[model samples]
Target: MLHVISQDLSSFNTLGLRSNASALVRYEHAGQLPALSQLAQTYKKVFVLGGGSNVVLAPDLSALVVKVESRGVRLVAESSDAWLVEAQAGENWHEFVGSCVDKGWLGLENLALIPGTVGAAPVQNIGAYGVELEQRIQSVTAWNLQECRLVEMNAEACRFSYRDSFFKHEPMGRWLITAVRFRLPKAWKAVLGYPDLRQHAILAAAGENATARQVFDAVCEIRRRKLPDPAVLGNAGSFFKNPVVSPARYEALHKAHEQLVAYPQDNGDYKLAAGWLIDQAGWKGRRMGPVGVHDRQALVLVNHGGATAQDIAQLAQTIRVDVAARFDVVLEQEPVAIA
Candidate 1:
């Protein structure tokens, strides 16, 4: 096992917050799980770092950081209706989706260009363009640190909800996902029900006869245009989740604000557009010291430069408070803050 003391993690996270791990361990194979478990036992705190797209890191971590880097993809099973494909946790999510689309494995196209690794997808229940990762997931293989063994969990066992899953609720370093299996349907259908996707010029041009590739390209283009590139300007895509409200609450909010942007859920609840709320709350293009809300997309919070995790947290809290005061709705941040 390769270990580095006092490792800098500024480049590991998408937010680019200057942080350091007391010790960093490179996890490239399944054989390392046992050692990782031992190390986790040794350290009072331990963090499993994937692609680092959905995290806000503190200035210093007094913990052992395990960097998941296992990689591979293969068709594990096949049937007339669907194909079961397995991908190692370390694979870049966007590239994996692109490969599936290229091979005509149709389901992940709507989620193209999402930043992160395969392992982290299910944890966040990553979703976009009217579809969530749970819809495509067959099973998740993870190392259970407490038991010190590998285990496979089905979709139902995963307990997937909007932008959340069982993994998120588990104790830190308790479960480290190593691979994910996806069930891609052979009978594919376009999911352009999302307003942004449905109204996109590219998709509109494609019309009713839109192919999987077009949908993939459209999502990529839309994300590229709206989201800031973490490489150039650090950001963790949408900083806040679209708040889901009860039907009665939705009706009340809608009555008060005529221009409320929301979508109806099958469960009769309504998912309010957090971006619209933030914009209406007067936070778009606004800054707080080194961090600020992305001007183009109100949902995103960007790190201008030299911003710390505390800076991001303070700004997020300020926005949450302001939005709550104005709209009487609580906005929840999506990114996990690691101290």
Candidate 2:
């Protein structure tokens, strides 16, 4: 394990928040888990830092921060129905999806350009376009800090539910995901259900016979056009989760505003577009000090420059309150904050 005291974490998070951890331990291999477990036992509190894409970090963290940097990818299993591929926790998520598509292992094309690491995918149940990571995940392997051993959990055991899973509920640092297994089907179909995907020129040209690579390219292009790059303008993609409402609630909202953008869920609920809500609430392009809602995409809250986590939190709270008051629906933040 490589240890550093007063580690600077400005570049660690996609939000580009200037933060520091009292100590940071980075391990690149599973063989270092035993030592990491010992340190976890010694510390009063521990936090796992991944690609730093989907997080809001405090200026100073007083806990031990473990940076999981393990890396590897391989074809683990295959059958007539599907191919099981494994990726280490630290692997770049977008790159992994691209690789799978390149190798003709289709199914993850709709999730192209998602930020963060492979290990972080299951934690957030990361989804985009028309696909969620849970739909493709086969299993997850992690080092259990409390147990001081490795553990594996199948997809069902992960308890995935819209933008959440068992990993999110567990105490921070309780489990350090080492790798993830994905089941990609040999027979693939394009998922252009979303209006953006359906209307996109690339997919529109391909019609019903769009290939996985085309879908991947379309998703990437759409994302680039909609979302601001973290490198150019620091932001964690979508700042809030789409609020799912009952049919009655959806009806009320629809009656109130005919232009409300929403999608029906399999469980007879309606997932309201958080971006539409925020935009209608008159927060788009609005700024509060150094942080503001991205002008192009209301769902994104960007750090204008030199913004603190507190600033982002306050702005998010204000937006939530305004949205709740305006629409009588609550907006939940997607990024996990660490203080």
Task: Give lDDT tens digits, candidate 1, residues 138-237.
Answer: 9999999768999999999999999999999998888999999999999988998987788988888887889999999999988999889999999999
Q: How many clashing pairs per prediction, in order?
A: 0, 0
**Per-residue lDDT tens digits of candidate 2, residues 1-339?**
446567899999999998999989887998888888888888888999889999999999988998878899999999999999999999999999999988988999888899999989999999988788888999999889878989899999999999999989999889999999999988778888999989989789889988889889988998999999999999998999999999999999999999999999999999999999999999999999999999999999999899999999999999999999999999999999999
208, model 2: CA deviation in Å? 1.7
lDDT of 2 at 272: 96
TM-score of each: 0.98, 0.98
Tell me the lDDT of model 2 at 152.
91
Range of the 10 consecutive residues with the lowest summed lDDT in candidate 2: 1-10
Clashes of 2: 0
Indicate the TM-score of model 1. Answer: 0.98
